[model samples]
Target: MKLVLNTFFSFFLVSTLFGQQYRVLPIESYFKDISFFTDSSFTPIFPVSDNQVNYYNTTKEQKLRYATVGHYIYQREIIQVIKKEGAIWASPILDIQSGVERGDTAMSQYLNVRGLRIEGSMKNKVFFSGSFYENQAVLPYYAQQYVTNRGEFYPNSSDSSYHQVNAVIPGSARTKPFKTNGFDYAYATGMVQWQVLKSLSVSAGNNPIFVGSGYRSMLYSDNSLPTMNFRVNYTLGKKWNFQLIRLQGLNLLRVPYASNGEALYERKALSIGSIYFQATEHLRIGLIEGGTWTRGDSIQKQAVEGGFYIPIPGAATIQEGINGKSYAYLGLDLNWRVWKVLLYGQYGRNPYSKSSDVGQIGIRYWPFKSPNYLVHVEYNHTSSNAYKSSNPRINYSNFNLPIGHPMGAGVDEVIIRLRAEWNHLFVSSSTNYYLNQSDNYRQLLPVYEAASGTNQQVLYETFELGYNFNHGYGLEIFGSAKLRMVKNPLQNEQSYWFNLGIRTALNNHYFDF
Candidate 1:
């Protein structure tokens, strides 16, 4: 088998050197009997104007055409069908990770197991890519029950899981194990694009949408919307573009919050459709086109109080609230390049009842033509009055509900990173500082609380490095450490992690026995 594989690879390389590269177009042609006009056998049949030949004579029916005015070749009605086949391309990657993390004081000393991940992409038009991951580290939880020094027990729970923990704690002597499923990730995505016109094309499939320059997006965050989304994109003229998308099933991988009392895995909802538009390569705007009715109840309505809130507070409140209703959003991004430096900024707003706004700006400096050597600095600001939680304490009770803290306020963060790369080797380091202030002032730490009664300010940081090799191999290392001094039960928390990865490719182009 090894010998046969080597022989196949040798022949594959030789064919790639001489075969005509595939070019997608409206029509294509290839003829062996066509006569070249430059040859003496071909003569101009029409009057020569300005010493220019008008037509060419050829024996093959596939090769009769008129010459254009300015030394151009023109084929009026010939259809080209070039038969070039047996092209193959593939990329595969495997990542292995091992890291240890200790959360505050109460969490158990856990062992970091090696996590494995494989991802790759193949193409000739049809492409496939996916990733899978698992880990044996500390998984985040929302509630827990513990015995105090007084021999009594305290049940810590979020608003959503309070009932479940309260009932279990009174009878159990041992601390109920907080359900943390170590580390988990998922695999998704397949897409296809077809060229329909010279300047227009269409693509449809399940894919991830990461728009704008901000690491976090208010309209759609990487942590929020990693699911199956069907989208269609259109290009108009040279400066305008449009997109329409319908997200049927949402895969909430990171954030586990759900108003419905169901297992995280069982909870599924239809996202309100959305439409996006871009003009002049500088600005983009998108809106949640409308709501979609599915089997599950509307979590948006449950997040609010009393099923719904009256706008006037009296005089017969609106009977039917905006349940399972649609929402709207708009976003804008701008990029400017001056010399070797580039600057970009993005701003977006989610116009739901509990709407939020986010903005970001960043600058990149590239002084050389290398793989990944650049200095980047960015700042992000997010403010929401609806979901702001003032509590600083970490809640490990229910993984499916948002702990009542402060909702609908603003948070600010600044990140500065420096990256250097040489060939397949790359190293990057960065730090982030978070300033969080919300409405529940008295519930926060004393160090940041002002006399005016506002939640205290806090900060978090992280750093990462990675490397990739030719022939589809790569590795990455990352670490995240947080320093917080909040009066809330959530103590100052910190953790560290590292990962190594490898990748390769396999291809069987039009295999024939």
Candidate 2:
């Protein structure tokens, strides 16, 4: 830790270029709706951090000329604790929700979350942000099942017998039972970026990487837990931008026990490279490539091998191919804006197999180009072998969750979402339909097999209405209802759940699957 800090400080002293403080908007639809509606020409690649948005107005302080206590209390970051050449801002994160289910098993559910976020810049050249959250919740039935099944287990310390062990929360790590049917877990993410030159920037962080502009991304999505990563972003001109990221991922399924009965997760390294080109005013295109490989003892001793650090797209994949353990992916992202609506699509595949692939198409329609309303429709399909690896340790996943899509693989899905905002009031609805057939989808080394029990269809719908009291950190009160139906040869089930709560909605909590 001390070495990293010293290195960062050394870079900070030498950075001579003038750059804006870098901060990314939350990677959730609720936080990005207004911005997308206002700026239709924005890139389809998600989590637009380098651009300006309404919610995160860094240039202007959110203070009225005649500011009072209420302005400081409800309208802005709780504290601008330090204001040198730059400012240090902090806010409390809170989400308290309660709900009840009326389905096969009628019961009550609740969520309690508390945390803090701090972000700022040093001399407007080096930027940093961090947040830590602690959460406890009793989830709905379907979501609970997803969590329970994806958890990792280890041998018992006393008897050396493996049984039901830790259940992982989605986008989080291991969890402990909170109550009768609840989970308690926590996660933290931080980022530091340095603008090295006029058109170059470097950053390192622990956060989910999102690479497409839809409800779900075929290339990569922030559906899994964040991992340690280093990224370099460069721009040649107005028409071309490039990014390279190197990250370390974990495969919980192959954990080796230490002498003290501690589980040591297997680690892998991934290198991702992408190029975006603004071909014309109406069309934009992006090409992405990546490769992942297990970090054996020879390579794990070092942070990254010299050859693996090549930034050119496909270099790592080509190098790994010679070693015959290549887990490479290639994808294309495209978006065209015409007649006031944006059309987007993605095509992704494992380069080694013809059948391991994913495809998606979607549209973001803003009726009459209104900033208050949005309608999104999307279709997605994944082949049975997509994201699977013969060597399970190098699958396209981290901590047992798929990094590409929330649903593991071998599925067809259609999703429709609608959103409207009127002053401080908002309402939204989402519907999803899924056809799943692969029994081995969730396994690391998945292979398609005909299993009658695996064939099931699901339909899910959710609606929510909320009133925003503050835009800073998105403090709002909301009421929502969800309906889920499952049909298969063995069983048919229907479920309904309703919730009411106030929360500082900042991150995405995906339970729709």
Candidate 3:
């Protein structure tokens, strides 16, 4: 303990003597993919969205066509919205994509996306950002099953034999019934950031975030909607960094439509803290701690967490009473760089409180001689009920989405991703296999029971080919094949999906799950 503390102080003192400044790129992929980043690990060690994105790399403008009109237009970033240098400035963010696809079944496969964003900074001190997104689609059968099972957008009353309604999306109202079994969803996100000191910064926003650089997250994830929150970051140059986040979340359990007054989605307080160290030029380590607590009922309006108000480790367990209602999560990960290759792994457990464990191991290799080619392989597993809870309102979920792992609990998966880039074009492919175990414990119950069934096996694969016609903008063709096999009852199914489109700008690509 003493040695660790001394190391931290030594690093801090050295960093203070020559404090360097760095900002986290926007959580969006475009900013990340086009910015100055550390290979596949991405910008600033993957924390939260509180860091300001002060840099935008325009060097990759080779694929652009007529993007610059000899000095009047530069990548269309400032179509003259406000292009003054060193003064207040702003620009429009636009993305439009429409495509036609088909599956084996009769369901229509029409995919369309429309998005708009407005972002800018003033005097390099204050900054603002906002985005609006609208999407409509005819999803494949397996993806459709995942959405309908959320139990949100419908009342859940086990009072009768037939009291369940299949729903497509949470926080979503049916969109006038599309051609076939299609659905629609809309989202709005915004944030403001202020740089107070070279070593300190703060931001308040309602935007989704993925906390880890890996393909999946075991801590914080963007699968859920933007939770209104505040974030603060402290850093001592590019060597050491720290972050704290507090979010306002919602519970998805629903009440009957016949009730006199509907219950507001139950409120939840999610607090997270993390510290990362660039231990050496080739090695880095990160420590994360978090808590999820419910509000209302007998509990007061204040935070009743076991861990410190600041960042500290704790077991995110659910006890029978107060101990049972609250949850805490803690974990650590390491990244090792050997020349051009990167190796990483993580281990997390909620033992005493929640009888579950989680782990991940992965390697990313990008040949130093040829940095444009890459290969990544990873394995992830979550014990039964790892993200589940005895309290419906306090489980590791927001609305209908799991905040930790996308598969929730009781699943083992292997992921392999390969990518190659050549000037204006890129090709990539990924495959995933998940072995899932059905939960043995009943919902909202404090006890457990023995499982009476077998596990299910699922396989998912995807391929993509994209070409950039304009600086940072392009056309993409993508497809996926999913297969699920079950036992006991005996079942097997296969489905395929595809999409092709031209986009001036694009948002996060979340279908990777």
Model 3: residues >4 Å from true position, as ranges?
1-24, 28-55, 62-104, 151-180, 237-239, 254-263, 297-308, 311-322, 353-355, 368-372, 435-454, 470-489, 504-506
Worst 10 residues of 1 by lDDT: 26-35
1-513: candidate 3 lDDT, tens digit per residue: 777657655643443332212223445544433331244332233322222322333333323232124222334344323322212223333333343333345444555656666666554566677767677766656556656555344333564212323443422322334556776667777787777886777888886665665666777666566778887878877777788777786654343343356544446677777788878766778887656776643223445454325443343333223356566667787778687666777766654445567778877777544434667788888887576555555666676566776666776889897877776577777788676644221222111224353467766677768764444233333333333333324555555555565554435544444
Each prediction's Cα lDDT score?
0.32, 0.72, 0.55
lDDT of 3 at 289: 61
lDDT (10s digit) by residue, model 2, range 388-412: 7666656777777778878767779
Off by over 4 Å in 2: 1-22, 40-46, 50-70, 81-84, 155-164, 253-261, 297-307, 368-370, 437-441, 445-453
The C-alpha TM-scores of every prediction are 0.53, 0.86, 0.77
Estimate, for each residue in 236-275, the C-alpha lDDT of model 1 and write its tens digit: 6655444444444321111235446643422232232333
Residue-level lDDT for 460 in candidate 3: 67
TM-score attained by model 1: 0.53
Looking at candidate 2, the ten consecutive residues that score lowest on lDDT are 444-453
RMSD to truth, every model: 17.7, 7.3, 10.0
Ranking by TM-score: 2, 3, 1
